[model samples]
Target chain A: MSQHISFVQREELKNKPSSDALGFGVHYTDHMFVMDYEEEQGWHDPRIIPYGPLTMDPAAMVFHYGQAIFEGLKAYTTPDGTVQLFRPDRNMKRFNQSCERLHIPTIDEDFLLNAIQQLLLKEKDWIPTEEGTSLYIRPYVFATEPFIGVRPSKQYKLLVILSPVGSYYGDQLSPVPIYVEEKYIRASVGGVGEVKTAGNYAASMKAQKEAEAKGYSQILWLDSKENKYVEEVGSMNIFFKINGEVVTPELSGSILNGVTRNSVIELLNYWGIPVREEKISIQEIFDAHARGELEEVFGAGTAVVISPVGELTWKDQTIQVNDKNIGPLSQRLYDTITGIQFGKTEDEFNWTVQVDEVRV
Target chain B: MSQHISFVQREELKNKPSSDALGFGVHYTDHMFVMDYEEEQGWHDPRIIPYGPLTMDPAAMVFHYGQAIFEGLKAYTTPDGTVQLFRPDRNMKRFNQSCERLHIPTIDEDFLLNAIQQLLLKEKDWIPTEEGTSLYIRPYVFATEPFIGVRPSKQYKLLVILSPVGSYYGDQLSPVPIYVEEKYIRASVGGVGEVKTAGNYAASMKAQKEAEAKGYSQILWLDSKENKYVEEVGSMNIFFKINGEVVTPELSGSILNGVTRNSVIELLNYWGIPVREEKISIQEIFDAHARGELEEVFGAGTAVVISPVGELTWKDQTIQVNDKNIGPLSQRLYDTITGIQFGKTEDEFNWTVQVDEVRV
Candidate 1:
């Protein structure tokens, strides 16, 4: 799928932030990629232009009915100075799944990947080389139709923006406390929970705020139906090491299929570690802790890579995982993933995709 | 509350469409009310400006995280040529509820009411006086901060726009076929189902489209957990008159607390009709039909007022409601509501709020 994407470079690039000052989603690159979708013309006019504000109609359907979807990934500067992405194809495919669920038009994944590569090539200097810092790629689509009814939009826009960022949780290996949410639900089966749509995140902001107020950094969500089985964490897929085996929640239709999650599972399989995906409940984790079988707890996502859970507070009960420290296995998974991401280790899984210059 | 709202009038007004040609959400009025919110200044700079597109950053949190909410009501040209609104206070209150759920800051309901009234006075000439025609009012707020993380935005914008709309369902009394959705869920307990936020509507488009594909105009959603008890129809609250008694779904956490639904319940009480709010399962509705006691089925909302259900198709079973004709009770409710809205009937309920010309 060859897409003729036009490029309009910025006249003067903005001053770059210091590498050490790069925080999550705080700084943007010089240019971005954009495409438009109309019911009759489908998607067209793919272009890379200066990063700026978008002129949207006040009655745009997205602002009214919220038909928006997004994907999150990162580009890292390898030791050999090569800019590469980790499982971007998976992000694109999952983005398509979100589009399907949100009733938005799906894009040609290769076309989008090419667009990202071209944009990255143009903004190559923006990729921070400092350890624990990279360029975060956010590809999102939203309804742009100037209508006010409760229906799918006829017009849409797809945009890809880049932001230089540090560690999502301020540290690569620091174990953070997670609040087990019981009152508020994130997503339910037969809904858009499995897809990375905007509403699911919007619906979680309240619980996240309350958790933050209680000094917790993130939330551990449960199944909406029964509120018994454990789901994913705020923005990552969760894993628990119990006794001699590891277990994560099955993708029971409401959990996000994280690319980093897939990598962690594959890495465990490659190491011949006992890993399984099934309906694991929060009470079960507490029970395992009671039985001295709760070995470790960690979260996996593109932003954090691997986040070790130090403590978990559910209602009135609190349990500390691995003595409120990063477990050895968690450290190994983080090192292996980041090692491959930064080109410091072997790419045996063939997961990294190097960006090469391509003619527009 | 006295608000010092500034106004910027358009020098040349656009030509208005014929009243007969006005469809739902097709044509907009000349001016709109706008307000901004910042953590430092709170909500400031309330103004009325020419209707136009909004310039927003491509990284605006609303575009990605969908922290957007909106309310819908209508303004009618009474028989005496006065423009008035129907229970807009309820919409404002509900808008605050949505804001609380989405973690967006709330606004003073009276101040917003005044803003809407002031905007309506300026656009009063645009209100359609034709039979079954009125001006639809849409007030919405969204996160405008240019950030990309999974958190509530620090900056926001609230705007009110007007659209001259005909009857929401073409003929107000025409019954619409409803598809009973079992595979896809709309909202679950502990979700944002009870609020009028953009995510809930965005999460519903695929199911709505699928129902349309199956020749149904709307979808009747059941409880997400059990998928048995009826929740609501698309964009409306549903009620069933079984064995000559009207029963609607209670304020379950996942169901919207509709203003029109409340008005209907009150109206039924005013008319001495046996009415109750309880869990009405689809199977129970089917059983009522089996016993030849399903007297009427209708949906109530700001858009449709009272939409008679012509048929219900659930999996393999298809039931024709009232032989595909409008029921008497549905017609009476529509007449009473629209009558009060247009000032043709006695305002015994004091539901309509008159828009008075105010000093800026």
Candidate 2:
């Protein structure tokens, strides 16, 4: 590493063999990566600093205007003790896409990947060796400008933080139940729906809570204009299998173009599974379920590689998919992706990024 | 005032003169009021401290989840130098209403009002004495929890920041041109649109930018579901006069429940002006303009008491309202409200709150 890029080490952590107990975003690592962007100097001061509080002006644009975007991926410690990341280039591309949408300045992909690899290599011990356990990495950028104008902020700050996360499924992998939200729409066409911005998630909290209150795991958002077509589940892209053909929502301006969603499409294409992206209305899904044509339904995201949907409740009607278990395609996609990520499979796509040598 | 409840006096800013140049939300006084709340204990440790940066965890829920709400009102320095606020109790009530929607714990109205009054008193000299200027006060509450959960945060912070502001109309109160946005929607029914949350404003930035790019002062948002009904203009509630009837978009769950909107309703009622809060579709407004029924259009908000809509461009059609000037009723309502605010008229509705003396 270059002397200028060197970070002061301040290890303050207890070694915990609690990978099995890791929940999503609950337990963080000891160190975090940071880089400051000044208006005159561009992005600079990149360093891996100890995780702590950040002092900010109360009038910072991010607090008042919600000009923030984030990316999510994981670092996996393979069975052979090598730490690797899955398709980080895809994430960096999507991160820049989100930046373009949110008006945040873009960071160079090589620099971001280099910084992340450096940090991960130093903290490789935080990556869980157990299956379905990994070091979840969150790279986010936000407007740091102190002005209170409604315009896009000029100054921004980018930071990366890591958390050791367990399987999205606590102990066993089972399909989850979801509620159909017809009244609340997460995003609309021409809106910032495709971006992984803070505002998009903040807007969905109420709907998520309402679904959870009614004993549902997630919410299935519909298109804002018509409230008829299926858009996306919060934080995940959904897919349905009907008549042995896979159908996912089209990349309308309002739905997130997820990295995992794209990966699933590639995997399905490789397996010669017919996949279509078009407007699939709620009524059509219900009709497919009634005729027993809907064989399976699943949600795709980084956290849960492929979350099969067991049941969907819309209005007063509830539709159950085939066999409350991971479907054949879903299982295969998860295995293939995970295998590649853990360096256990052929590097056909060259998706894995190996970390450099460093001690925690 | 009790010494325990008072803020330490920082008299460095006592010599600043009130001018129209001291515009809205720009110039701050020396001190601010704050209170903290934890799940273990409700709101406590109320203090008036020097205005400065706040130390926050990078993972604080507000930055990530947009769990924040705020209210805006002004402290007017009357012709006789007596400081007063217009309908502060209404703002306090609305502030709590916004809190309930965002799941931020509420504070007692009396305590909040008293704290604001004390703060205003300390900075009474900062209240602009210019004809259209006032001291803008922003009271906000945000999630302070340092976790990445989607649920409502357990810890919260409430703060009141004051800034001396001049008239929103720079140099002149001229009518502004607006562009109707047919593509993007600001808020939707069953969403947090009615609540003055940060997400609502954040969501409007793109639309506003698009409008600004087209040389329009602000964007006129339409209903998300149909994109046909007139919802509200950016940061303001809209009013339309068609065929001698005063009509405003009803309190659809999507539009904000603006304090100025409510005040206009009451004033129209007091003046025996026939008013209706029914759906005002864009088609109806355009048809009315074609038939010479659309007489006047204006916007109401705290910043600008009444901003007349000069012209509206919807798609390819452009419609002019009364040669882009303030209408008769618009002028009367603006005068009445500002008259009452500046103590130039009788306090018939008892809507003003007198500032308490700052004891230091």
Candidate 3:
């Protein structure tokens, strides 16, 4: 898979911007890598074309049945002006996991990694130099077959697009408030909860909007079954520190196996911090709060390394943690992860993939 | 809403041979109805346009976040040369319910119905006159905003595409074999199980495929929490006849309020059948089967109306229903529902909506 390399030169960008303001996903870099998979062709037509709109049939399976999967990672411009990706192998593995669940064709890991590296190299200038900014890479696969059937699609399109993103924490890394929803479940067992598919996030928007309407930053999703155990915070995995031990929900098939969540587990283990991946019920956390054993609570994801859980509102109960400020563990975890990503710390795990320079 | 009428001429369709072979969703009608919604403009630009590809941004909310909702109904041509829709108002109301759950704006029921009628009148010829054949109408909405942020899209596009469909049950309406999955759940109690959202269907595809691999036609889902209570099949609502009583799962938040399910209840009530909506535990079902009290089991939806459940395999215990054929109640229900739909019987419930011919 690594030996087979097919690269297509993209037409020059028609309207390249200089010094543009950083917006979320509004702007795209010069090129996008695309690959098509048909039952007959078996993953052919690999090309890198100029970033533009994709023409898709109205009855495409992705549009109607939501047979779509996506992955998110970032390319950082380090202090020494070199572009690098953090733990792209993890993203690739998770991407394949998503493909398997959605019945989409899985690409060779080496091929995907090499293609993304080449794409980033071609559009390296898009990586932001600002301290808290980077180029966000989006890899998505969807059913492109023009059919109205509710079955697995035979045709698929895989694409990778790049967008420069500003700081996800906004201006300051302030602790954010999250509303606890006992009524809505984000994912469930036997469902595509562990997969990074589009439906999980789409199903969460209504509850999220309700949380925002109630003056909260995000929604903390509870387990669907009993609604007693803590699941996730939509886009991120959660952590609760009680009795000086870090506790997060075990992979119950209803919560995403986030990359950042895995990183935190490894980092905590390396730092000799006790971390337990077991069921953490809401009552236990409240009980721990009553006993002064609840130390800190935070969320981990690719966007934000660790967002401190400032306050929680669940069923007429409000629990505040660490006086609305980032806790020691949260700060340490964020610094360690970002430090490794930006090349400030030693790459003991060798997670960074160096982007080769391309001569213009 | 009725005063605001915007129309586009229907484009001519290419004629295909009668024996062209019909696949599930492969072929589509020539024209499609589209409308846009925004915060500033409530609902505008309603028109029928040539069916073709849609140009969407790579980062559109629907592509990445899965913020999509849809409804499925059909236009049937009666023997009297009139085109009609079966329980379209129910579909419209359910469509709004789905929209509310997804945070998408709702359209006026009358306006949507009028638009659909106009569109169907133009494409009346596309409706097949063959027995058990009709034009499947699909109305779907998606987030069109190109943003990477995790929020509801302010801009949305609603479109209706029509496809000619044959009988879901082939020549002989044979009862289907189902796999009862106790390990996986199709939906959780507080999830988007009730809404006709794409995410719910997306979540069920894996389980459906697994059941198919086991030589079963569908999967019988269990409650997400304990996997104790029987919920529903992915595409249709399930019902059981035990001890001379019609029993179905109650309207739990995790189950869809299917229009077909409701109509069956009404028809049963009119026919003096004792129907009850309650939590029917899997254990109870199995016990009844063992006691020879379980008379029949069938699924109900718009596509098939009523499909009998012949055999169910649950945890190494395969239970075959009486005689492995359609039960008396199922056959009668199917006859009554399709009779009303095709204008072969009295429209006691006034479920049919007539499409008047217009000189354009």
Candidate 4:
């Protein structure tokens, strides 16, 4: 695809926030990448414009029907000052998968990836250099059609915005308590659970809020049917170490296919650790813990690369894993993934895509 | 609940479309009612503004997380030259119910109803008086906070827009062919299926589109767990008549508690008809057809008060319902409902709320 990406520089740029003061998704870079799609003319008029408000019809379909999707990835500043993205291609591909499910028009993955790279280059200076901070890239698409009917929208807008963030969890490797939610469900089989759509996140807020009220950091969802089999966490894929083998729930139709989760599995296999994917149940985990075989539990996702699960409260029973501390394997996995992301370790996996510097 | 609605009329109103050309949700009235909500101030700044675009931050939470919900009701112009709304209170109550599930802050229902009534008085001319046409009123709420984190947004917006719409099925009483979907579940138990949220509608679009491509008007969704028992049709609650008894899938947690469905149940009881709400499996319906006891099937909702199901295609078998025509009972229910809405029949049920004229 030809790159006719237009640019509209902001007349006045806002001062960057201090790196130490940066929080997750709180501050945005100066410019954002935007593209519009209409039924007659496909996606066109790609541009990099000032980060500002969007003018939309009050009757846009997205407000009423929620036909929206988003991809989350990060851009990191290497020790040597090179900007690179962490497996952005996967995010782009998964974005199209979500589009297919939501009945939104799919975009050219390669073209969008290139657009993000260009967007990163323009805002490269905004990438934080803090030890635990990076630039969070949020690529989202939503229905822009000015109609109230419940159907696929004929118009859409895709935007890529950058936010400087410190870390998802205040302490990166600190283990957090998880509430095993039995009352609310995030998604179900034959539903849009596997896709990264807007609704999936919204559907999780109630449970998350309730869990937070109970002093839990996140929710560990169970299957909607029997409410027995373990599913993914609120925003991450969960894995457990039982007796020595690492096991995560298989990619059931209702679980998200996390890119970070995939990388962790590959790394585990590379390290020659025994790992398997199966339909493990909550009862089985409790049984394994009761038998003193459950070793560790953790979650994997982009925002929080590896979140160690310390305590789990299911129903009336609460169990602590690894003495309510980060397990050795969880710490190692976190270091390895962050090392790969920050370009400190060798890129043997060839996962990082370097963003080229713009030539004036 | 004091009335404090401020108004700003459009300088020049757009010409209204002809009543015959008034398709569903295509044309908007000259004005719309809007309210803003902040955590500290609660819902404030209720006003009627010109129907136009809304300025929203690009990173608004609704576009990314989809914490949105809406209610659909109608305003009708009676033959006596009075304007009234059908069950607006029920819609307001249901709106709060949806808010509770989405973790959104609830609003004052009585105050909102008063606001809508005042807004209707401003745009009463837009209400069509055609036999099958009426003003479609859509009241919606969405997250407007410009943060990208996956949590309940602190800021929100509520808006009510009016669109002059013709009959939902084009022909008011025409029967529509329904495709019984064994795949692509809409909502599951312990999920947000019962709420009139944006995600539920977006999640059902793919199934609806595929059914439409197969020459079906709407999809009849089965329960997500078993995919055997009937749940609902896309956008409407479903009912089946076998032998002499009318049956609807019970208000299973995943099925929407529709206003029209409730009214139908009440009317059936008033007429001394046997109606039951149970978990009626698709197999049972098919078996009932095989035994020559399947009498009729229809859908009920605000859009189509009584949509007779002419045929149902489940798996590979297609069965004609009531010889592909509207059932006598379906016709009577439609007449009773529309007659009450338009003030042509006695208001024995006290369903309609008359909108007072704007005094000069």
Kindly list the per-residue Cα lDDT of model 4 for residues A32-69, writing each as its tens digit.
Answer: 99999999999999999999989999989999999999
lDDT of 3 by residue, B138-159 (tens): 9999988888778888888999
Per-chain TM-score, chain A, candidate 3: 0.95
Task: Provide the lowest-lDDT 10-residue window in model 3 chain B.
Answer: B16-25
Model 4: DockQ score? 0.87
Q: Model 3: per-residue lDDT, tens digit, A225-258?
A: 6788888986999999888899999998878898
For candidate 4, lDDT tens digit of each residue in B88-173? 89999999999999999998899888888888889877888888788898899999999998889999999999999997766558
Q: TM-score, chain B only, every model?
A: 0.98, 0.95, 0.96, 0.97
* lDDT, model 1, position A284: 96
Question: In model 2, which regions exceed 4 Å deviation?
Answer: A1-6, A11-18, A38-41, A356-360, B1-20, B358-360
Give me the displacement of residue A24 in model 4, in angstroms.
0.5
Residue B142 in model 2: shift from native, Å? Answer: 1.5
Instruction: Going through the candidates in order, state the TM-score of chain A alone for each one.
Output: 0.98, 0.95, 0.95, 0.98
Worst 10 residues of 4 chain A by lDDT: A351-360
**Pairs of residues clashing in candidate 1:** none
Descending-lDDT candidate ranking = 1, 4, 3, 2
TM-score, cand. 4 vs. native:
0.98
**Candidate 1 or 4, higher DockQ?**
1
lDDT-best of 1 and 2: 1
> What tens digits encode model 1's per-residue C-alpha lDDT throughout B53-150?
89999999999999999999998888888888898889999999999999999999999999998888898888888888998999999999999988
